[model samples]
Target chain A: MGINTFNIEEQGFLTTKLSEFIRWAQRNSLWPMPLGISCCAIEMMAFAAPKYDVARFGSEFLRFSPRQSDLLIVAGTVTYKMARVVRKIYDQMPDPKWVIAMGVCTSTGGMYRSYAVVQGIDQFLPVDVYVSGCPPRPENLINGLLKIQELIKKGVPPKRDPIFI
Target chain B: MEEKIDKIVESLGRRNIEAEIRQDPLGTEMILNVGPQHPATHGVLRLVLKLDGEYIVDAVPELGYLHRGKEKIAENMTFLEFLPHTDRMDYLAPLSNNTAYMLAVEKLFGIEAPKRAQYIRVILNELSRISSHLVWLGTFAMDVGALTVFMWCFREREKILSIFDIVTGVRFTTSYARIGGVAQDITDEGIHAIKEFIDNFPKELEQCEKLLNKNRIFIERTDGIGMITKEQAIDIGLSGPNLRASGVPRDLRKDEPYLVYNELDFDIPVYEEGDCLARYYVRLDEMKESVKIVRQCIEKLPSGPVKADEPKATLPKKEKVYTKMEELIHDFILTNFGGTPPVGEVYHAVENPKGELGFYIVSDGTGYPWRLKVRSPSFTNIQELKVRGKGNRRDDMVGRRGSIDTVMGEADK
Candidate 1:
């Protein structure tokens, strides 16, 4: 019999709701692979620091390895050259992954309208949430993380092409 | 290749050593690519380290990964429009970069900010220096596994960021400075907040020092790992705290003395040790000295107009332009035509947190700079890594973290 078809009622072991438990566990402890590139990276670091205390939300476990991480915080200017690296890191990350584009540069090319900078990273990779600012304040970063938690709790919506104006 | 090897072997024969027989020529050295995405490499710095069994044989750093072609972009944009772009060059001390670029443009226009503006610039620049060093300290300490110091340093840095947020609109990349003067005048509330930060920061610094100053692991990890001699430092053009740690008492604030720095009485700390620990100590002491300078600037701040009264060169405040007809027309002309600086090339260097951040601008009597070249300190400072990393073991790489503090943004720019 398939595991889904095998009734827990027949076994009578008193199990918790699998999807709810998975969502709760994933939402609470989202391991972030901090892909810090520039100015936004500093703000991201500040968010992880003592005063902001990213640990309070249990996302403080910044796993450098992509395989261990669920959330990718791309915090800085993503130039055309660095986009390949960003994509490689994203591809390496195990499935059910989320991306938080943590600056205007990542969401859409902020001020850098030149040949070197990638206009927006979303052309290649799917961005889940975008925290906008030249470099957003640590408080804004926290709110973005909370929003991600909310998304995880009530399943992430189907991927949509983000509008860049 | 065989002939060259034979010649080397023949030369070594007189010394009773065969060059070819020393080791098999077929043995390939292992190449380790250490980033473009490492936590310890600071920000997107890739080092291709060639190793012979844990000993770094040669290290070749790959640049241009973060290159945004800032100089080329500056050529297209108006001089005033380029002010915000300067913030990204050395993102750590954006105010310092902004000040340096503004001073360059001011020189080109043959104008100077009033005494009050000068004092405000000095205070803000010093605060930027302190904040930049705090980031270096936090990252460097974290690389060495001293997590407490990172937290302690960031706590102090958060206060500085909030201060910047109050004074300037943004927190991190604050494009606060303009050509003739600063974008906004420092209000009484901003001054009060800075004073409070200046008062409380020293105690916080002391706490940070207590955590890492004489801690056994901290010292062991940092102390003598990367030693740059006085001659080597001078030869390679190392500046800022990195140069000072090697016993060179060359500080731009003391040497150049731009913007009320001459009136300030502060001692430059120099250490003769020329090691990673000495560099760390030099930055620590410099932060205290920066506090002293900021205190002096605040006390002696003269009251006057922040922006220079040059309508052709400077745009009027939004409130003035909206309410007044003459100001609106003047703003329109200024924005559309832009300021025409004389056809001259001027290079202005500032003591950035990293090192001597110099901007070389060649103006062709147009609104846009003809040629803009940046002499970023991290560009030269990072070159010393190859020299320092040569003798150090692969494991010693982490220990040598505090020696060379390079922000790849400035380095690549």
Candidate 2:
């Protein structure tokens, strides 16, 4: 059940599923843990800046602390050394958290197919959305955030089973 | 952990700080790890600070968290292929990095970019300087508790990025500069946007300056904090505005006069007081200088070909390649095998937004460089933290590091 009827002047009550209410709350307020590692981080900052204004989607609060955030926006190249730190941060974030791989470098290692860079972050952490660009534009990042919101609204659980290191 | 502490102590002994550590009344020297992930460190730069109560006893900057084996990759790829990778190094000022790398390759090839290309390069380089400094100013202001300045800086920065979009077709990683010239000519729209940005930029810059330049809290936080003497700055090899802040007038644009810098009239903003505020002021003044330089370049903009007439070193035009058989063959060879420079070595440095970004390439008369060493300014600039961070209050550490402004990608590379 959702909002069935409404009256401005009269005392009225509306009923909705508890899950629906929770999902709506969760979808609207996905506090991001910005893992701004490189070039994409600039674009990520732009997403949060006055121009793109991620605050409109209710995801403006960029929690540097993983424990306080529900969304992990890994916004650059993830090297092998940094992968451990990334995984640790991902583990620290509470349940129902989603990951947005915000650039080509984080997605399939992009052009940096070196020994140092991790081929893809999905090898260690469960990434929900992949925004593809050498460094994705602010609009592209916003589109990725919207997709994450859509996923939350649909109640799709994040795939937590990462490939064992 | 025990060995690490011992090593630190031994290093401190060399620096003559062992007596102070040994004579401490309260054995409360705690180690603080600032990041490989924290926000203020600015892109995976980790600082391991040894703290005595509220004061930092020593600061050791542990780098390489963002090292993508850039030099190693450069060894494998052709000169043209490696240009895009340069964008990721100093991610904030990609155009400067692009121009720096291209200049190095051009030196090896013994060919200069055309006058038009030189002017365009200068314009882009100065624009990137403004953008990079804006990011640094925003993030640095955030480090010192001035949140409003960050938003204001980014608002101005967005205008610059839109201009980048018009010129280079990419906003963030504009790998626009080619070996002999830029990828394309600056359009009429691009010129118009730049002119508009330069005209309106100063007022926006002044608004930001008003917020932080005289605000009591901002002054209290930055003034007399992270003081590095002129000698210390020189000894530590601090470059860019950081060195200039310490009263060293070693600007590459002024001293070396690369591209059309000699043609343009701009001042080097140097400060004798090498504190955090001095660094801030130098950068602020430098941004205005950058605006002036861009305006001059626009006024002195040439109409000739942007690309140099070097068939062996530069790529053929796409239209010409498609139309003519000879040009198509040249394109195929250039794209696949890349330009072959004579067996030699060349080191070229540009006044990047951060500092002197120098590339040393040793070629074996092949399509690729035998050895490529990136003399990234951040790597050298970060060393001052180890020297200057001692005895400062722990809270001031963020401001100190921000004032220096090291990007991890360049540092680690």
Candidate 3:
């Protein structure tokens, strides 16, 4: 069923706020395509593994395919060469998708302020939650995921003029 | 490289393969991009596979997706300031990276770390090796469809990380080693924790071996796959377990014997077969050897200062810096300018978890190095992919996963 095709009047008045219900459901099942590029990717995997368990927040099934996922976790240092590939993957994902910049490197280039590294991935893709650490702790990554869920639940307006071609 | 690709094409031609579709109308030669995003390539490594039906005609590995110009960054920062950057190189094995860089600088300065500090470095480096091998085992098994082994391996790895947290203060990016010695001394509790892990890890390894070692599917998938001769492995400059798997036994620890390794008694594991199974076995045996080394280190653990008293080479303690005037000046000089080694060059190599992780530093009597070149094992090991990928089927790429263990952090550095 299409997300927009749901009818409120045909269903009932008991479930009056259908949009809230849709938003609630949408926030819970955020499938992330972990764009694991460097050191931060290891911590992201730790978050998915038994200890941190990102699945507890309903974001554990790491979709390598961009089409199947809505949450994009860019988890490492993004280089200038990789920026093109990142943008291409971002464009490939369907509308109503969120991006989480999962480390200091992806958020602000961290320690690597070089010609090769892209300053920040937000310049290339719209970032929802920016987890700041050299490579953030799995707990911090989980907290960032929670913040993204909160934004989804509150129904923030979709970004316009986000991402480089 | 173009000549090698053409040679591979020629070899394919001799096996009734046509170079162009125009020459043979029914030819099925196709170029497939395996990833910069795909899961099986491990971390962002893109392989362009030239295929004819199911067989791989030739494969080209495309890197620099994760290149952060670590060496270039090294030229900008001081030798001490750059220690943290090495932690990101082989992110799985930070201790080994730290020791390798530290040894190179120590050599340049014509100084040696104290016996206690050397033993501590050995313990930490070997622990790092075990943790790295744990990750390799988990990911390699996961790639081969052994799902249960991945979870099992991580379960064991978490215990090691906790042990690291006690001594190093951080789990993943542990910038623990300094120019002269480690950041802090290992406590009695830390020693006990290491002993505890050493005692417990072997039993866990036994369980893992039961799950994987004799498994028919594992043997069938990996036994004869990705075969490399001793000459090919040596010519391609493979080191660590990958070289040892081909029966070379060219471990830097045994050959060069740095960081009190000559004092420690441990055997280097070697295998006659240079297949995927042999590589896997070599790592498993190495982990046991690492445990042996750690146990010996703890037994001969010296009680003394971890950091050297050299005012020029190392940072002074916070108490000394705050209280004493001479200490204050030393601290200022150390932090602002860093250590100034002699006007010379030195190359220090260590048997890292991956392979031979070496640092070549050119010091121009400055705090910052004139040039720092890293001879990363993953960078050299990935070349074997070109040699092994030839004549193998497209699907057999998974079997020839010696290069998949290469971290882009180290490989592209």
Candidate 4:
């Protein structure tokens, strides 16, 4: 059986009829907005290239003007001033959006704990998946995408908004 | 009360929000501010655009958002300690940044990176070029409304980052490239992963080419956009793909021949269109060339110590430092970071992912440089935006901006 099928089988022990199709769709297509910051942004680029082919899952669409995007992949460090802009971008996206906090910088600010960095983007935005690595490999991003699909299927819509405005 | 507050907020130093409605001299066009903070502007650069409604008449780029006094920082930190900070300059290619700065210091001390270290640096630098090109391709696509390409590119990039992690134990801001040689040696797993990645990437390239390389939309959005003559490109001091696309065959790796780049075999892809499409094609072709270089670096990988065997110039081995008292003290000093360099001036330049990243260091015989200057590629590449942004539609400007692949962090730094 395919990995997705096996995953469904393993988790299907107590499956909900309502989430089955949603689970399948979410797993297959997790469109991500590439919120590139720095060098990690380039690695994020590599992940999207032919060798890794993120499109196989159906989320290859990296929407820029966030209105159409459903996923925000933070791929670099969020500096002090840039933090506000990141929040604004996340807010601009439509509902049902997922934030895959790619790389340690966006996950926990990585090794740069300087005064200029915001530590982790999650402090200001609700992160759905935190992909670790000083700068994560394309494999990590792929795995993170799958994990986010799992999270989406879990169907727990947490009500924690990082900003009130 | 809210309306008044909103008006106050809107008027309060809020520059470059929108060009649709802004004040300028009569007969002047709509002024599009490309950035104060933008994706392709490369760092915190701001552009004052004068558009005749939609056709830009003039463009002026305002810079200095990342002016954190880098030269001043160099003055404060020891020579080796300052290497990591240099990594932030052209961040998309930190290894190149690291190498150029390290080479500057090494030149001052008159030492060479070990053969093994040189080989690894060559591999990483070429990989950095490929990574940088992917970002350029993805974002350039996003700017043109081809969002799908971005995700596809990121998927492939993930593998490269993993390879980097295996070698350096860190990614993004890798201080892997250090003075005298690389700080850490590449492990066996790292080499295998890289080999697999290289072998598998060609098909991915084909997929991407199928997706957009010749798509009608991709052609329509980028073709003839951001047009520049070869003479204009040269006059502007444009380097890297921007220059190559304009029919200039200038590559620091070929011209300057630093590191093992001289020993490596690869092709430099060039084009003569001098437009958005040309630039895009150049970078895509460059990615293929970089892959060629990566493979060559792997095939000829030599065996030796990764760092210069010199004491005082290179850090002592970690194993010895742990056991030997004298070595331990040296290690402590290297980590603690505050030793002076012998006074002199040296400039080191590298063919970075963007373009030429040059470091000009003036040392007053101290660890800190008395005066430090970085010749950044993004900053130079961004300069061309002024020339291209003119006479373009509002929507078209973004696409034109994307072709340049400007990284604000490097530009501003």
Each candidate's clash count: 0, 0, 0, 35
Tens-place lDDT per residue, model 3, A1-165, is: 213334546764343367877887888898998889999888888888888878888888899999999888999999998999998898889878888898888998889999999898878677778998988989999999899888877788545443343
Provide the lDDT at A111 for model 2. Answer: 95
Candidate 4, residues B175-218: lDDT per residue as tens digits?
A: 88766888777888999999999999878977988989778988
> What is the full ranking by TM-score, best candidate first?
2, 3, 1, 4
Candidate 3 chain B lowest-lDDT run of ten = B13-22
Off by over 4 Å in 1: A1-16, A157-165, B1-28
Kindly report the docking quality category of candidate 1.
Answer: medium
Who is ahead in lDDT, 1 or 2? 2
Top candidate on TM-score is 2
Q: How do all models score by TM-score?
A: 0.91, 0.95, 0.93, 0.75
Error of 1 at B334 (Å): 2.4
**Residue-wise C-alpha lDDT for candidate 2, range A1-165, written one tens digit per residue:** 323456433666556788888888888899999999998889999999999999999999999999999999999999998999999999899987899998898999999989999999998888899999888889999999999988888878877864552
Chain B TM-score of candidate 1 stands at: 0.92
By lDDT, who's the top model here? 2
Distance from true location, Cα of B171 in model 4, Å: 4.4
DockQ per candidate, 2 decimals: 0.66, 0.85, 0.73, 0.20
lDDT of 1 by residue, B259-329 (tens): 88889999999999999899999999999999999999999999988989887787789999999998998
Clashing pairs in 2: none
Better model by TM-score, 1 or 3?
Answer: 3
